[model samples]
Every structure is written in structure tokens, then in C-alpha cells.
Target: MAKYDYDLFVIGAGSGGVRAARLAAMAGAKVLVAEEHRVGGTCVIRGCVPKKFMVYASEYAHHFKMAEGYGWTVGESSFDWPRFIAEKDKEIARLSGIYVRNLQNAGAELVHGRATLLDAHTVEVAGRGRVTADKILVAPGARPWMPVELPGIEHAITSNEAFHLEELPKRIVIAGGGYIALEFAGIFNGLGVETTLVHRGPNVLRGFDDDIRAHIAEEMDKRGIKVILGAQHAAIEKTDTGLVSRFTDGHHCESDVVMFALGRAPYVDGLGLEAAGVELDEDGAVRVDDYSRTNVENIWAVGDVTNRINLTPVAIREGHAFADTEFNNKPTTFDHDMVASAVFSQPPIGSVGLSEAEARHRLGKVDVYLARFRPMKYALTGYSERCLVKLVVEAATEKVVGCHVVGPDAPEIIQLAAVAMKMGVTKTQWDSTCAVHPTLAEELVTLREKYVPQGLGQAA
Candidate 1:
């Protein structure tokens, strides 16, 4: 008789859990995955996938303007919120189905219910009874956080609700300075909504390069987004006009929608982690080792719940590594460094490795290469929009430690740059590459002069 119901019982079928389940099952381990909500989790259902589609839809407003600048006559354009939402939901459903199919094809059984750890090796599903496993993996991911203490906060929504909003708002007040807040601000503004961004910080895109932060904020203002800094929402009150967001400074703004993109927290509440004896960090994230093993030897975790590099790709890699270590007899650990990331805000941003400030702080003296120029596509269009490409090289080792971009195709450009940086490419090696003619990416290679910020002499 088998000692347990399955070899592996996976909780939360997000990207990480799904990948681990599939791989373990393929390795001849009996695996079962249980998800309370949709199988696709945040990225596919409510987060990145749907958000990117909205970004694409919102970008047409600029395309129309650029077309006119290029001397091409464009017709009257309109956006139907209901139509877009319906189409987006359909595609999300299709993706969710694909996730389910992939798990089954890999010989992994799945259950549709919330699974809570009853013990180190036991999980109890909502509808189903308790199930035992030799090993268990938790990858419940995270949820958008809202300040519950604030007055009338219920009137405000998060990015999750933003996707399913029935009607388009005439104006929106997005609170936060992070990528999610900025992305939605751009999305709403591009769709012709009067958008105002409220942040407690002095600038948007905190933790990004200072120049990138200032440039994006300036561009956002030029793009018609009212960027309010060093302010936070004190209250949100419903009125006949719409929603009134009262700031801490005694001022207020009325908008049809008030969104709190404050950030996300790992979804660990009511998960019965206490019963399972799983340790959590001070931030409420599951505490795990590099191999993703929990304090309980038979238990493991990955993805947002672990809170190490919360990107989806990182989660998938962690899951694969966990599966390899436990099932394939090959120990593996994901390298969290130099992971490329992109923001789908207006004009977009792609970045990899350390920020300029981080490089300077860690590596002491650093050489900075920066280029800001109008992209060729906007040359004839007469648009003032400019692209920025910057590299931070360690002065001692001459290694390119950071690459940041804020402009057209920045995400795509940063992805390739990440590959070279991951391979420990140096400034000379990066410069040796020939430039691709008539391309925004060409500016990366063509940068020769080192940038020295005013007041900071020599290397920064």
C-alpha cells in the first residue's frame, strides 16, 4: 500500500505550482494540484496578460496622433469598454483552459477548491476531504493590497477590479508610485480619461534609475497625466459627481474611479500555514531556502508567496528548479540576479540588473553611459517623445552591471541586453557589437561619451 495519497500535492496552480506539478508528474511522481480560484493565477487571468491587452488597446490613441503627424489621414476612432472586456475575458478563459489541459497532459490530477495545509504532509480541500502526500508545494501567489483603515476605502478598487469595470470612467485617481499605478495611469489617460496619479513618494518609479524616474515623470505630465507627488489618500467618499479622493494635505479630487495600486501582499491569510508549521517572514511571505524548501522538510514553496523576485518568469524557474531537485535527482537553484523586467506604461520601460545608484553604492566608482534622442519613428511625426538608453559599468572590473531604457521597444531591447549581462559581458564587448541601422536599439551600441551629471565630477 502507498504511504500517502500522492507523491506530491501542489497548492495553488499558478505559474510556479503548475510548472512544478507538470514536471514532477512527468518524472513519474504522483502529483495533484488544487486551486481555489482560476488555474491561470494572477499573470494569466487578472495581472499581466489582461493588463497588457489593455495597454495595447489604450495605445491606439497615440497611434492615431502619430498617423496624422506622418501625413496619413485617420478616421474617427472609439473604444467600447464592454467589447474590449468581453474579448479580454474570452481570451483569458482560453488561456486558463490551456493551463488545465497542460497539467492533465502531463499526468497531473487537479481539483477545483481551496486547499489548506492541515499538517506538514496533509492538505484539506474545500469540497474534498483531506489528502496526504509525501511532499507538498505551496505557490498561492499574492493579492493587491488596500489600506482598510482609510475611510471609505471600499469605494476604491485595485488593478484586479479595474480589469472588470463595466463602464469606462471619465476620470481616474490612481494612488501609488509603483509600476502598477503608473501603468494604469497611462492606460486611463491614453483612453482619454482625465488621469491623476497620487503618490506618497517625491517621485514615481521608486528604485529605478533617478534619470529614468525623472524622465518618465516628465513624459507622463506631457502626456496629460497629473502627477501629484508626496501625497497620500486620507479618505475616499462617494458623491453624486463620482468618487472623491481626499488627500492627506486637505485637498481632494473627484473622479469616476479611484484605484489604490498600493502594491501586493502574499496571499497567506486563512491558508492554515500555522497548522502546517510553515515559517513566514516579517512581511508575511513564506520563508524558504534557496531550494524553496520550507522549515518542514517535506514542504516547499515558490512564486509570489515566497516573495523572492516576484516576477512570473522567476516563479516558473523556481518551480522547475524545485521539481528537478526533488524529482529528477538534480539539485538546482534559480539565479535571481539580472532578471529583465518591463513596464507596459505609455512609451514603456525595460530594465535589467542593478540600478545606477545600486551599482555606485555596491561597486564604488562606476562609469555611466547614457543616450537620449528622439526615435526615428517620431522624427517625421514631429513628436517630442524621446528614448533613453543607459548603461552602468563597474569601473574596477569594467563589467556592465546595469542597463536601463525608457522609450520605444525598451522591454524587447532590455531582454537581449540581459542575456549579454548574464554572461558577464564587459563594456568593450558590448561596444564591439555593430549598430543596426535605423533602429532605436542602435543607440545602445553607438553611445561613446561617458555621462557625468552636473555637480558630480568624473565617474559617478
Candidate 2:
């Protein structure tokens, strides 16, 4: 064989790349992974890990208020934004070190610099020597997208800035109708920001089940988050006090800062895929097959770079499948149907399998069971917030085709269903099981009235 510097050359040290690099090395392939920034990638450093920490911090404010109801006194419910940010930063730094250690222990040499493809078999580092490998993997991940049409757009920040804000702004406006915008708005609002969420669509989280979206909208409004629907941003001008954002509907809302949860784009700007003979989707995402192999031979791509589902776990699965099929030679294929995901908005949302609407469209008949009521803790706080659980089953097969929930602890509750749905669980199995009494999750089995319908929204 002709001489090569490494057996496998991996680009982007994000979730997918790290996993691929470590596993390829463990499989006895000489591996070298190049990362421009940190080894842990966006999820560990900037995205999910840090974002969830902020969510937890924002949640404590409500927990402190609820403490009064549980007969425990929460004196001086004050928060230090700087302290929280520092603590979160510490957690990220600690986790990032672990990722680097794992890569080294697995025998993958981790290089720190920007890597550009010189050819299909050769890559050049910004200031280092050329690396020639038998196979290459790209897992560049994704970054947030912002709009420029709005005048004075410099005031807006994405989720990256949302986490590291030095001092929490007293007033803020969040744009976009997606989960990121919704979740951040909830975190900021819960932390006592005079917050408004503006969405161009009729509602936020539009792709989720309609019932959950509607109930969540009601809950968001109840929580004092002003929702401006069917509106687009025209401009954001800085003023002496804060910022004023004009809406396309000829209205204006003023806030100290503006954020766009608009959307995310694949991080493929400098990855020389064109020269490597790799194909990409119109949105700049590297298109891969079931095995995560790009169009070019011996080259593969995975994770948010592919724009397939754009969730952390999905990226992890893609990486594992790519390593198994490409390096390990086990040749595994993944079936991505019936994926489950959770959105951590104020009244959180969790969904799995076909939506109620989707089930009716294809199967035409569905049995939907819905449970809605005040959770036990809400009675103590006098909050009057309600919880909902919806189940959609195939009428003919009695298989649970979909599961949806919108409420407090919805993410925790729906995770159980997510696993069960992945196993192709049936409604009979769900009902035949005994219920755990008095807990919110037990509502999944205690739903009253077996719903049967074929109407537009009767599924829910």
C-alpha cells in the first residue's frame, strides 16, 4: 500500500466527529481529528449543555415562588446572572476536558486548527503539515442563522449570545417561531425579563401537534409572555433607553435587546467538499445515504451537517452508524423513522411517531385519548396551570401511532413514551399495564373516554 500519514482523518470535533474519531481509533485505525476551536463541539460547549443549565437556572425562580405553597419559605429570591454564567462556564470547561482526554486515550491525535481539504485524500492545516489519510469523515455540525433585512440588525443575538450575556437584560424581544426562540423566551421571561416573543407564523412550534401548540400558547400567555403572532421584523433601532423593534404590521415594540431564533444553517462554509467531490443539499447540508456516506467514495458526513432532524441524539446515532459501517466494517444501516424529540419551552412539549394529523391523513382512522387537568402541585401554588396528554392509535391495528404531551415535566414524562413508541408499543399494552397512582406520568394510562374518530382534529 502507498504510504499515508493516518488511517482516518476526521474534521470537526463536535459530537459526531469526536465519537467517530475515538471509535475509529479503538477499531485500530490510526486517527487524527482536527478541530478549530474546542474538542467538545457546539453541544458540549455552546449549545445543549450550556443552554440546559440556563434553563435550570431560570426554572429555579419559579421553584422558589412555588416553595411558598409547599410550606417552605424561600427568603430573598434573588438571582446573580453573572454567577450563573460563571458556573455554567465551569461545567462546560470540565466536560470539554473529558472529551479531549477520551480522544487521546482512544489513540486519536487531536489537532487544533482549521482544516481545509486539499484533495480527496489530502488535507492541509492552517499552520501545520499536510495530513494524508485513507478515509475522511466530515461532521462539521450547524450554527444559527440570522436575517439582515431588518435595519439596525446589530442589536440581535442568537442562542450563543443568549447563554453568555454578562448582565441579564430587563427587557428583550425574541424573533422566530421555532423551538430555540420559544425556549430562550421562556428562560428569559421566567428570569423576570419584560419579554415578548414575535413569530411570523400563526403560532410558535408550528411543526408540533396543533393541540399541544395551542395549549402551550395559552400557557405562555398566562405566564405573562406577550406573543405577537403573524408578524415579521422590519427594523430594530437602538435608543437611549434600550431598543425599539418595528413590526411589519406597522406596530412597534421596545426592549433592551433583540434576539433572532430564526433558524440554523449547516457549518460547511470552509469545508472543501466541492474539491473533495462531495455533494450537498440546496441548503448547504452534506447529503448522505442511510450509511451516512457522501456521494464520493470513501468519504462520509454525519450530524447537523446533514440537516437530518438536527437533534443531538440524531447526530450521535448518525456518527455511530457511520463508524460501524465505515471503520468497524460491521456495515449497519439505520432506519430513522419514528424519531422522538422534546422541546423545552415553558410548558414543555414532547412528541414521538406520526403526529395526530399525520396519522389521520394516511391511515384515515385513529383513536385518540386526551387527558387534561391541573397537576397536583399547581393546586398548592394557586397557579391553575393545566397538564395535557394525548395518544393517537391506529384504529385497525390498535398500535399507538403517536404520543404528545404539553405541560410541566412533559419532557420527562414523554421520554418514557419515546422509548415505548420506538419499540412499536401498542395501546393495549399501554392500558393493560398497571398505573402508578397520583403522579403526573400515571395520567398516560388513566385517560377517560376511549376516543374514536376520523375527523380533521378529532384525533386529538
Candidate 3:
């Protein structure tokens, strides 16, 4: 048996690390969490919390414009970018302190420094020096992955810098096809920036369902965001006035700023995983089993570093599950399929389970239920915004394999869908239910009617 300095050594105090550290400490295990940066990690500092605030700030322009419809006299509307950024910073700082306090309250040692593997059983924190543990958890999440080359690449920024812009761009060209790209596009366009979304793929969001992607593209165009699909950015250069992007298709877009929502990669370059016998996946993410165990027997990983699912809640769950299984000997495991998620685009999106394409590709027959209509609130605002709900089911069993939605309050609405899906509710179950009137969620129940609820693969 290897005697160690602590029972659990946590690397990267992001969502996963913090949760694991706290849980392991509560289990009466000596825990030490090492964070190179802040306690709240990406989601709190850069990823979800900060970005969503930016999104909210961006949406106020529409709210202010539409206030006249509510019998309010509005002369003119303006946004103060500096004020929003300052408020965001203050909120982040407050949250960071809370995280720190929570760790201390749980009696876990918080080490503020970079962590590198000294051995399979040991890690050395820069400045703070060395520490050893019976088991080590790596929760080092991902960073925005920018392309490697370009002429004036220095002019391009990632999500990390997008939240702190001094002023909204007059013209912005956003690169990438991922959800980050779409979210940033929505934020920029909503704030009245002349936003051009340049996507290499035919659709903006690659991993989502085809219909959802197409719907968002249409809505983005409706919002005045130029959707340039199936286009690739070749190079970026600086003109005397602004940044210019040259596309492979012989067109150029000049913008005051260029941001890449380009996606993210495992932030595992400096943790010395190689020395610790931890293996990486094809895309350089830390490879781990379903139990969150790495190649190193006593070492485990969670969050974006593992690349299991890139959502914040997934990371937190995975981290807690790992601590429960390892420190508490609870034998718990993470179910990737059970993970539900939402995208905070202009008209937010949410999903749980298999996409329609995934269902069709994986199973010989799949049932699709789709519903689309304008929401009631939009009627009042004279906004033509639409909501879409789709369900994909296994043809033979009629198991509710997927739930998808796009429109307002998607993140909040998807949580209930996630619970229903977790309980194995089928199309028949949904159809037999009553819907709350004039709400977007009723669309879920409405979609079930179109599914032809006769069990999957059943003959007419």
C-alpha cells in the first residue's frame, strides 16, 4: 500500500475539482485541491456564468426597444459596455471568494499554484512545492481552440477576451461552427453589432440535430446576422481601418473585430500527464474509463480534460461521482446519456438523449416527432421568433431517445424534459398528458401527437 500525504489530490479547481474536493472532504478524507488560477475555473470565470451575463446584457437592447409596446414612453436607448464589464468582474470576484470559503469550510486544503505530476502517486505545485496522495483527480478543463496559422492572427480573439471588449464592434466576423460560435454570434448580433457568422460546415452547430441547426440558421438570418455556411476562412490581415478576413471562396469580410467561438481543447499540456502514466485520447483529451479512472491506477480525471461531455453540469456530476466512488467506496458511475444540456443562443436551445440523425444512424428505424410555431410572448412583442420541439425514439421499443427545443427559456425548460427522459417516459406517455397553456413547453406534448405513437418499428 502506498502511504500518501492526502487521501485525495485534486488538480484544476474548476467545477469538477471543487465539487470533488468538497465531497471528498465531507467524506472525512484529507483533500488538497490545487488550482493554478481561480477557484471557480472556466464556467464561473469565463465559460458559463460570465458569458451568460454578456448574453443577458446583449439582450437588453431588444427589451429596451420593445418597451414602447408596454405603454412606456422611451426616448432613446443606449448600452454601457464598461459598466456591464465592471459588474461582471465584481460578480466573478465575489463568486471566486465563495468558492474559496467553501473549500476551507469543508476542511480541504486549497493550493494556489500550477500542478505537475512528479510521479504516479505524487504531484508538485509550483511555488507551493510537492504533495502526494492516495488518489489524484485531474479536472483541468478546456480552452478555446483557435486555429494555428493566419497572417494577422494576433488580431483574432477567443471567448476568453470576448466578454471584456471595450465597446461592441460595428462589424464583427465570427469564425467556427460550434455552439460557442453560435452563442457568440447571437450575443454580437443582439447587441446591434453587424455580425457575420462564417461557418466551415453547412450548419452552425455540428453535434446538434439537423433541424435544430437549420432552424437556428434561419432565425440568425432573421436577426440580421449574415450566415455564410460551407465557407472557410483562409487568412486574416489588418487594413488601415479594421481587421479583414479572406475566405477560401474568394470573398473577403472586413470587421472591427474577429472572434473565434471555434471550439475548445483539453487544457492538459503542462500537467505532466505523460510522467504520471495517464493516457490521452485521439484529440488529446485525457482518456478515462466510465468510472473516471485513468491509466494510472490511483489517478482519475473528469470534465473537459476527459472530453466525455463538454457541459458544466456533466463535469460537476462526473467529479462528484468520482469522489463518491473513490473516497467513499460508493461504486457510483457516470452515465453520459443521462446528461442533459442547453445552449444560450438568442433563442436558447436544449436537448436530452439521442439526436434524430443519431437515432436513425444507430437504429434501423427511429421515430421522429417535431413541432414548430411562434410563441405567445412573441405575438405581444411583434417578434416572429419561433420554437421547435423534436423527439427521437427507438422504432422497436418506443423509448424516448431524445428531446430537443429551440426558443426562449430553453435551458429552464430542458431540465423537466431531462427528468422525464430519465424515467423512460415514451411518446404515449407525453401525448396522454396535459400542457400548460400558452407556454413554450406545451410544444413537447404537442410534438408527441405527430410521432404516430405506435411503438417503434411497428407495422401500420
TM-score top scorer: 1
lDDT of 3 by residue, 24-121 (tens): 99999999999988889999999899989988988887777667667667777777778878999999999999999999999999988999998898
TM-score per prediction, in order, is 0.99, 0.96, 0.95
Candidate 3's C-alpha lDDT? 0.87
**Candidate 1: stretches off by over 4 Å:** none
Steric clash pairs (candidate 1): none
- Please state the error at residue 75 of candidate 1 in Å: 1.5
Question: What is the lDDT for 59 in model 1?
Answer: 94
Better of 1 and 3 by TM-score: 1
Q: Candidate 3 clashing pairs?
A: 395-456, 395-457
Count: clashes, candidate 3: 2
Model 3 segments beyond 4 Å from truth? Answer: 448-460
Poorest lDDT segment (10 consecutive residues) of candidate 3: 451-460
Q: What is the lDDT of residue 180 in candidate 3?
A: 85
lDDT of 1 by residue, 354-385 (tens): 88889988889999999888888898887898
- lDDT string, candidate 2, 1-460, tens digits: 6578888899889888988888889999999999998878888988888888878888988888888998988888688989888888998999999999999999999889998887898999876778898899998788889787668888888888888887999999999888888888889999999999999898778778877888888889988899999998998888899899999999999998899989999988878888898899989899888889888887888889998888877877788888888778889866778888788888788888887778888998788898789888788898978888899899899899899988878888877887888888888898877888878888898775875444645434
Best by lDDT: 1
